[model samples]
Target: MAKKVKVTDACQGCTLCTMTCPSVFAMNADNLAEAIVAEIPEGEEAAVEEAAANCPAGAIEIE
Candidate 1:
């Protein structure tokens, strides 16, 4: 099944998520990373999980 991901308020706008998974995460107007897709595409799950795991602020969440 597809998974959901989010950048929480703890996000630091470090651009890591955007860099790791541009297809699923992006920098919004405020520069904070936001999930571009409601649910992660089947192929993008690994990238999203990597972004979440590597997040320095522990801001990215996946469920």
Candidate 2:
């Protein structure tokens, strides 16, 4: 199973995660990266990790 991810305080409202993994991540009304679990599939773990790795602020956390 894929783990849940949280956006941390380090978030700078950067859209990198959203752009990198649109299925799991999106930009909120405030332009912050929000995880949309309904859209993310269980097998996309690598993609999610890639998005997290690409985040400049290190905001995405998997648990």
Candidate 3:
């Protein structure tokens, strides 16, 4: 199943998520990361998980 990914308010605008998964994540005007797509793409699951794991603020959520 496709996972649902989100960047919560806990994000610190670190840009790590965006760099880790540029295809699915982007930095908003506030510089916080946001999921460009609601559903994680087929091969992008690992990338998303990596971003979440590497997030210093632990703001990325994958469901």
Candidate 4:
């Protein structure tokens, strides 16, 4: 099955997710990182997972 990603309220406005998975994440107007794609793109799951793993605020959520 495919994966989905989201940025939680705990985001610390850090760009790590954007830098780690630019294809799937981006910075919104609030400066917090957000999942840019509605769904995780093919072969990008690893990066998404890594972003979540590396997020200092532990704000990234994957389902």
Q: Model 2 clash tally? A: 0
Each model's TM-score, in the order given? 0.94, 0.84, 0.96, 0.94
lDDT of 4 by residue, 21-42 (tens): 9999999998988888978999
RMSD of each: 0.7, 2.0, 0.6, 0.7
Residue 58 error for model 3, in Å? 0.6
lDDT against true structure, model 3: 0.92
CA-lDDT, candidates in order = 0.90, 0.82, 0.92, 0.92
Candidate 1 — what's its lDDT?
A: 0.90
| Candidate 1 Cα outliers beyond 4 Å, as residue runs | none
Count of steric clashes across candidates, in order? 0, 0, 0, 0
Cα lDDT, model 2, residue 57: 92
Candidates ranked by lDDT, best first? 4, 3, 1, 2
Clashes of 1: 0
Tens digits of lDDT, candidate 1, 1-63:
777888899999999889999999899999888988889998888899899999999999898
- Selected candidate, larger TM-score, 3 vs 4: 3
Task: Please report how far candidate 2 places residue 54 from its true position, in Å.
Answer: 1.2
Query: What is the Cα-based lDDT of residue 51 in candidate 1?
Result: 93
Local lDDT at 18 for model 3: 87
